[model samples]
Target: MKFPSLFSPLKVGPYQLQHRVVMAPLTRMRAEKPSLAPRPLNVEYYAQRATPGGLIIAEASPVVNTGFGSPGIPGIYSEQQIAGWRKVVDAVHAKGGIIFLQLWHVGRVSHSSFQPGGALPVAPSAVAISSEFKAMTAEGKVVEYETPRALETSEIPGVIDAYREGAKNALKAGFDGVEIHGANGYLIEQFLQSRSNLRTDQYGGSIENRVRFLMDVTKAVIEVWGANRVGVRLSPYGIANGSGEADPMPLYSHAIKSLDPLGLAYLHFIEPRSSGAGRAEVNHQNVPSAMVLYRPMWSGVLITAGGFTGETADAAIAAGHADAIAFGRIFISNPDLPRRLRRAYPITPYNRATFYGGEQKGYTDYPAHDEMAQA
Candidate 1:
């Protein structure tokens, strides 16, 4: 009997995964405000997708108490928040699935109203990201993305501590592991890019210095959750929301080298195209395979996301380029994505209109093949 490539069992971190397929962390801002807790709808949403060989990393969770960037985005900074996620963890586990929380901080991708005491969004330098999002106000809604305040050299430890606390919260919430969100031009990525992070201090001059914040956060998170239970996501060549890097390879290589000693679960790379035209939407386009080239250099598992299909994903695993493949948008519409892939079933395209800030229209309404047939 020829073993199915995608269905092959693989040991990742401390978990013995049933398959090499992973549900990449995709944001659906359904968590309620004040508590920023995952709703019951989220519980039903993830539980439906849980299956053996399936690894689901929950959406971006704010690490610091100060970061309240997205209106309905969840946070792991408080006890109430941790309790909320516990419910989610329990639901996913009931279906015999493993889950990890993706720890995040949006830095300048935030507005002043979202920060603690209405503080300005913080970044490596005072530079604001060349992107904009809706901001809430008392009187009425307004178009505002004030320039972010720069993190003073002395205050960097607090930011790192926030990630450590988030890791502790994940463990308390009963998560199998935690994935650090260091991609898509967010806070961590903002520091890595030379264009966005222009400072005379040690944190901005050289590639090693720029990657220090990310490395520090990774180390701190691993300390809270054992090395094997921690994973990180990166977008080396990703140019999203007007973020541009002079040279992505050298900075990311140095970052990986710094993380090699940590022995984390896996190093998940976004595999962005050099031209930046195809950023997160993965399809027929192929990355240069540069990030995977350095996989052997690291001590832990390696997972590649962005535009992966059955054949390509199988080939990547077979070739030792990646231990697993993470499917982002695909999992939204196809709850039984793994089964569908194995049986060669037709995929249900996701509705873009209901992707964000909706009740349940496009959130959990998408059905599996069996449900489709019954209907």
Candidate 2:
């Protein structure tokens, strides 16, 4: 009965959730290398986090070989990778948890080393990410990002095909649904924001043209899995990976209004305050809240993720600002997040050093609340 609204039953799309503490899709970079497939360790990590009726959006997975930016992150383009994800899905389901795979492409955030034949990464335009941001090559060396090749109009369909195929593969992998990773500074955001997308094709020019790629990609994925089983994440005023708009209202309002009629599973937002958490620990004071600003435009379930604790998350749900709250960093340290929150147990602080690219040290080794008490 504690945090009543946060622990209340809710329905998203075709499935029902016992609690509203959704697991935000996090990039841990711990998949099997070379193959870039989810291994047994990854399976164990997900299974440990699975709670009976909880929703876990798995990490961002590239849709194609060229889509890779970091080493060890999983991909959905290969038979081997599909088999790897099948294991993950089966493990989560065995625990009675619902899992969704997030389809992603890093676009210009990639490097030549991560590309095939050392070709430059591709994006909507050839613009390079500013020097303020850094990219990791396949060899794990930190280097400045190079200007990417502007995707030819003819080649655009191939990219969309990758997403559609990824959706089909996710279905084959036994996932309950799929989420389009349109947030952060990835491919979709590269196309949505004018700073990254400078193309004059159908995917650029005016706001309508700029949003064309996102719409086209969403429709393609919907064709594979119905709109009801698909969700889209957007960061209207985010500054992740050097992505920002001169003005975000007109652009995001148009995007939100456009997706409203699709009847999709949900519209997820990354609150502007915590948008840069992927790169560093940041809390921007006086930033506008995404859910509060855009909730009116979305008629379906609205899930927003940011620096939300148990009390704040409950407050958000009680205020009708968001239907559910997704937790990221805290979820990493506490596998039994829902139970801990429900009982108001002490939360273990996360070790940022071991957040990405590590073994059981900071992952599956984290003891559940009961185990800690027994110890």
Candidate 3:
């Protein structure tokens, strides 16, 4: 039951991570101000779990003003925001932990309130997605999803530049690396799936055309933080935020093949099928070869996430299935998750309440093993 395999040093692009336990990026809207930036509380929350040899991908932060779809979510487009994130990055590094900022753009999965001056949401096509997002409305909160303004062919480069600017800001903020949030039915993902993208331009239509947006974003980010410091999160079969791919295998194969040349730090993909109890099952035909297919395509590290536990993660690494594994909810409830996994300690269930907005009740108050034992 030893995790020596998991504890082994591994190289990701240009940086070396101490262990394979990565804290997956999870949304926790706790920024002090809606349009401002991360505050001391956010810094404290991350710093508390900054364990040696572990990697923490911070919560998804918007890359541009129009890309923001949630209130109180951090952004990397402003100078003040960079300074705010610097504190968090420095705090984590001071504790001997590696941190990455997940740059994001929500596309049409946003409300008018989340956009600038209450403008309409923007996307690849003018078509309105059946998927709706929660936002603050004048008459209290609502789930009204508005039709988005389709981006003209000329305006696409500006969107790519937003990711580059966010990457630059991440470096200024002292992050070890940057992870482009291309998964979970976000902007980059929306462009990849035919269901969301109805454009007939170079950015949409054929598989190569549909994958153009993701490629542009990745290349732009590489310019800011060298390809070695960049990573991408993709969900081939992810069903969140109103997404369904008619044909994902060939679509992703083309996309990953194009991205392989970038030599990114790592390409993290959500296992197409996963059990709720942290077990991965290859149940989808669209994602051919899984990690095997991706390894040959991308010359950098390959990490797998979604519903993985300590035992499962170790097995995957030992079997050469993945270089590393990321944990989401487990890390939320157990900051010392790596240590607990080492000893096979019983994990305390996470409280459903206080997951999003609330005091630090269930956020950072979870005690470590020794504290629990003493209590």
Using lDDT as the measure, what is the rank order of every candidate, best first? 2, 1, 3
Candidate 1 per-residue lDDT over residues 47-95, each given as its tens digit? 9889965799899998875665667888998888888899999999998
Query: Candidate 3 on 146-195: residue-level lDDT in tens?
Result: 78888888999988988888888899889989999888777898899998
TM-score of 1: 0.92
TM-score of each: 0.92, 0.98, 0.91
Question: What C-alpha lDDT does candidate 2 achieve relative to the native structure?
Answer: 0.93
Q: Is candidate 2 or 3 superior in lDDT?
A: 2
Q: Assess the local accuracy of residue 289 in candidate 3 as a C-alpha lDDT between 0 and 100.
A: 41
- Where is model 2 more than 4 Å wrong at Cα? 1-4
Badly placed stretches (over 4 Å) of model 1 are 1-4, 131-144, 273-287
Residue-wise C-alpha lDDT for candidate 2, range 9-124, written one tens digit per residue: 88999999999999999999999978999999999999999999999999999998899888889999989999999999999999999999999999998999989899999999
Better of 1 and 2 by lDDT: 2
Worst 10 residues of 2 by lDDT: 1-10
Q: Considering TM-score, which of the candidate structures 2 and 3 is the better prediction for this target?
A: 2
